[model samples]
Target: MLTQDSMPPSAKAIETAEDLSSIAFGFMASKALFAGLHVDIFSALADGPKSAEELAGAADIPINRIVMLTTALASVGLLTIGDDKKVQNSPAAQSFLSKQTKYDFGDYLRYQIDQQMYPFLLQLNAVMKGDLSDDAIASYRHWMADEEQASVYSESQHAGSLGPGRTLARKVDLATASTLLDVGGGTGAMTISLCREYPNLQATIIDFPNVTEIGWRFISEADLVDRVRYIPGNAVEVQWPGNQDAILMSYLMSGVPGDNVEELVHKAFDALAPGGKLMVHDFMVEEDRRGPALAALWQLQHMAFTPDAHSLSVGWLTQTGKRIGFDVDQVDNLIPAMTKLVVFSKPS
Candidate 1:
């Protein structure tokens, strides 16, 4: 039998078996949330609290099934059942999971995590074993080569990215910037946000052909078709449009190969105009390599799908930019605790 003395420090640190089991069964809670989203459980409760029968009627399912799902969701904090016997969405679920809400990112969870990342993680064991073949782990860019997959991924990401893009707009100043190059800009959501924030800003998003094709629709819908455009190609290989007053690369560095990161930074430096700025927003760890749990988890998940993805930290990025002769302007959080934005400037 395993005794206290035999337990590793990490295992011994856990105060209770319940805590350990909760961590082990964490996937069950996630699956409950996914199933709730899949069946529109949150949407059925969006207007107000509903009795189990009413939810069943709204979902076109039997009461027993709805009750089971709602019970699971309630257990996971996505839904709550009251003394009045009505089911209601949690504040977060009502805000971000209900299809009726403006900030709905239900599809990001449904499509990206459920359909893509979940399947990609099945090969994690092989990936961690130093197996780098396509069968073990394919590059994320390779997965996006399929037009259909690219469209679905880009569309979901666009829905999820717009809020962050707006946040980024509020944080960065581009008052005098007339031209921007959004490297690997997915669906032009960030570009649209920046253009809306800075009226004089005209932007270009360079991404894969399939992704850019879908991005045009979002750009058009934002009425930014004239000000924001797409250049479809590999970001690392393409001849970037030069003389850009600013370059925004959000969530791009964490996906590319480790060897290619410095090269891309140098390229971004070359592509900027004199006195231009480069903004890199990504999942970066702390200098000590300790836990900022979500950022570390995101980097691990990215590596499961990417054969050569690099681990990054704010310190390394600051050092790389400084070595490339760019001046460090600022470093701040982008997505609350999950991401950081590092801004560097080219000399005038």
Candidate 2:
């Protein structure tokens, strides 16, 4: 069984003064990073290092203002200013934050966190105390119901999940699997990744109608439309395209109500053909819940807007899978400290 004591060293809670200070000023750091992305600071340095004046010229801002933002960005470890006063992207920033890189995920932070969740988080206290209306706490579902909101969120989510999806494709062996059912498959990110990894794989994605609309565009762009398709509706209520070789639920379990998680796992089990594999990937706390702070924080963020969302744990999922007549095959970190992957197999 997955246990807290066995968690990696990275999962430990903050205990030092530096960590405490970082946590306290975390919002400022987030905004600084967002501001850097907004002004295309990382992208501006993508070509080569530039002086503050050159950066200001590229971004069309005053040199003084550019320096101010760069100071903040440098303090946050995303940028570096050499003794020559030339600014350049840090390795991490250049790889994942700069638009020049194929691995760019700036939209994940820019659109999803900055534009959507950051604003909604202001109501966290009221929602926690039950002072908010049910409609308010469940605004995520409402967002999914609207075309524009769903498109924006889906695009950001697509950007974020693609990296994880690629990582998952490397971790999971689906060579023999010909069919996949991707539950809560936003923008077909995982499906596209899996299809690319396994040439013979054909997948069906189940998600909101509007989300599926955006997903089709992504699938077409990936040239996987013939191999991937979407069934638009809630995964819980919709008729799942079952009898599959594999079922993937990436980032789905945490967004759902606690009571629904077991049912969803059971549904995945029932939908799979005998010997089928089920892979669930999401933000998970340790059994003891001390934390890998990022995982806990993401759960809390979801709770602020999704009142019924579950804070999942490795032990909880292992127990649920075994109880549903599946054998736990493997449990490993999918996105390092943030998300986990639990794989289970049905007896043939």
Candidate 3:
């Protein structure tokens, strides 16, 4: 029944079974990559090309396991192997994965592995029970406070806001605006970008003390110290500075739990003088939440960390702004990549 010619069918079945089995163990591959990064494998490659044994010595990993680890990384296209078997970083690996590059994503990878992986692994439990575990919450709080984690968060925010910010800047005339208040402006990235684009604009960054310290350094480094002032305090509880012509709440309100979002928006409204503008940029999901892969992923990631946090729709924001005595308009799809921008104005 199973002759050599007939064996091809069974052989194919066997191969398929093996592939399925390997897929079941895919987590091992991720763990291997994480282990390599934790041991500074990419950093070792940054200096120059080296063999597996040499890399192990440089990274202080066990000599016997280095070949397997290097082979695993090469298989994943992170490393290139020469005819002589020397290992080197791939082009993409050098540009982004290496620690030396300014756009290096190693910190982001480290954050995911160290801060998020454990809690994310509990997604099933969270969905089944409709709540996050205590351990997950603790890990999330740690992530939010850590500078490395905050930097990753801030960088993602900056990248997303760039297109939208540029579009808004071009559309809205800001030559007359004197002062801007950026609530919860971590690292002053958005505010700095705004100030740099609009030379006449001056801004105040309001955030927690630690974040403000980092923001101050960023502002100083950007040579914007003269234009931007760092205000250290909770944006919600603190009395916002007056005489503001505009306010930017770029990616801030979602972090505030349920009812607090309304309070924060109202506070921003009150801070603005008549005819002043408030810009809120964030990921707003469709009411159905079935599409937009990135937004859906971010929603799950947000829930694992934040209490009473969900992506707000643009319609919801407009209604809330209207209730707070401001005329609201939705800046639909400012960025080709992003979903929504809700701009509210206080009547002069």
Best by TM-score: 2
Better of 2 and 3 by TM-score: 2
lDDT of 1 at 82: 93
Question: Once model 3 is optimally superposed onto the true structure by TM-score, how far is the C-alpha of residue 225 displaced, in angstroms?
Answer: 2.7
lDDT of 3 by residue, 168-264 (tens): 6765555778899999877776777778779999999887765676567678888998899978777777889986899988666666656678888
Per model, state how many residue pairs clash: 0, 0, 0
When summed lDDT is taken over every stretch of 10 residues in candidate 3, the lowest stretch is: 1-10
Q: Candidate 1 residues 146-227, lDDT tens each?
A: 8888978899899889999999999888998999999999899899999999999999999999998899998989999889
Error of 1 at 28 (Å): 1.1
lDDT of each: 0.87, 0.89, 0.70
Better of 2 and 3 by lDDT: 2
In terms of lDDT, model 3 sits at: 0.70
lDDT order, best first, reads 2, 1, 3
lDDT comparison, 1 vs 3, better candidate: 1
lDDT of 2 by residue, 1-348 (tens): 345466766545669999889778889989999988888888889998999999999999998899999998898789999999899999999999999899999989999989888988887899788898866765445679988889889999999989899999999888889999999999988898899999999999999999998899999999997899889888888888778999999988888777788999989998999999999999998887877778899999887877778889988989989998999898988887789999999999
Indicate the worst ten consecutive residues by lDDT in candidate 2. Answer: 1-10
